[model samples]
Structures are given as structure tokens and as C-alpha cells.
Target: MKNTLKNKDISQTPFRRDVLKIFNSHKNAIPLSVIEQELSSYNRVTLYRTIKSFIEKNIIHEIVISGEESKYALSKENKDTPYQQHIHFKCRSCNILFCSELDKAITISLEKHKIERLDIQAFGICNKCNIS
Candidate 1:
């Protein structure tokens, strides 16, 4: 965790470390409410700021799904890629949001437009849910 912060040039702070730990422990993206529940002693504003900082540094990314609170997950590092371009899947049975890598690269072309980031979401029963 400390190495991740260092790589992103983020200062090593106790609160930041704790927040990263929460993200690391979970395989799925989490909402702010969950983080608050886990770190109940921390101030809400502080947590928000920490999340913002991580986003700015590309240490994490936000997942926005309709009719639900925004969720956050650690960014997958790709030294050659400047932006994250992957699918976010939500299991309807478990309601767990997680990232999934695309099988092939997606190509998009827009006339006179620049795309900085792309977030695609799919909702269905995930593998674990399908087996049960």
C-alpha cells in the first residue's frame, strides 16, 4: 500500500493508508457509505478528500451506475495506457460491482472529439451467481 502511494507521489498518511486498505480488502467496488461504516471514527469530509486525491492521482477510479450511489475501485495499472477502458459488471443477484477486462480492444471514432475516459457497465448474474 505504501509503495502504491509512493508510486503515485501521494504522501503516506495514516488515514490514506487505512482507506487504501479497505479498497485492497474488497474485490468489488464500494460505495462511500460502506467506507464510512468501516471507518466510522474518521470524519466524512476527510474521507471525501482522500478519495478525491486518490482519483486525481489515478490510484483509483469511480464507477457510476444508474439508480445507485457512485462506487470506487482501485485502478488497474497499465504503464502504456493513459486512461482506463474496461467494463464494470454488476451482478443482479448479489449486487456486487466489479471490473472486467475486455476480451478485445474497442475502437471508437468521433469526428472532432476527444475522449479522455470511458466507462462501460453491464448488469446481469455474475459467474458465481450463475452456479447457484
Candidate 2:
């Protein structure tokens, strides 16, 4: 976690570290409410600031699901690499958003334009939801 902060050129404050830890521990994208439940001691504003800083530093990225609250997850790609483009799967029943593996790096071309970043999400009932 400390390495991530250093790589992102962010100050390693206790609050910042704690927030980063929360993202590290979770496998799926997490929302503010879930983070609040885990970090009961910290207030909303502080958490918001920490999240905003992480976003600016590229330590994490936000996943937006329409009609639902925004969720955050760690940015695992290296700083030197081009913007990472992958897929996200959102479970309709449980409302959990998870990162998906890409068989190959996604690429796109538009005339003379080059695509640097992309955010794609697919929604359906998850395995757990299907089993239940």
C-alpha cells in the first residue's frame, strides 16, 4: 500500500494510508457507504477529500453505474504504461461491481484520433445471485 502511494507521488498520511488499505482489501469496486461502515471513526468530508486526492494522483479510479452510487477501486496499472482499459461487471441483484480480466489489451482507433482511456461495464446477475 505504501508503495502505491509512493508511486503515485502522494503523501503517505495515516488517513490516506487507511483509505488506500480499504481499497486494497476489497476485490470489487466499493462505494462510500461501504467505506464509511469500515471506517466509522472518520467523517464523510475527510473520506471525500482522501478519495478526491487519490483520484487526482491516479492511485484509484471511479466506476460509475447509472442510478447507483459511484464506486472506487485501485488502479493496478503501472504509471509508465498507457491508460489501462478493461471491463467491469456489475451484478444486478446484489449491485456489486467487479473488475473483469481482458484476454488482450483493448484498443480502438478513430480516424486520426487515438483512444487513451476507456471504461466499460456489463451488467447481469452474478453467480451467487444465480445460485440463490
What is the C-alpha local distance difference test score of candidate 2?
Answer: 0.82
**TM-score for each model:** 0.85, 0.82
Q: How many residue pairs clash (N, CA or C atoms closer than 3 angstroms) in each of the candidate models, in the order given?
A: 0, 0
- lDDT of the candidates, in the order given: 0.85, 0.82
Off by over 4 Å in 1: 1-3, 78-84, 108-117
| Residue-by-residue lDDT tens digits, candidate 2, 66-97 | 78899998776666876556899988899878
Give model 1 RMSD, 1 decimal. 2.5
Report lDDT (Cα) of residue 67, candidate 1.
86
TM-score of 1: 0.85
lDDT, candidate 1, equals 0.85
Residue 31 in candidate 2, Cα distance off native in Å: 0.5
Per residue, candidate 1 scores C-alpha lDDT tens digits across 8-108 of 77899999988998998898899999998898489878998999999988888898877899999988863547554689999999999999888776777
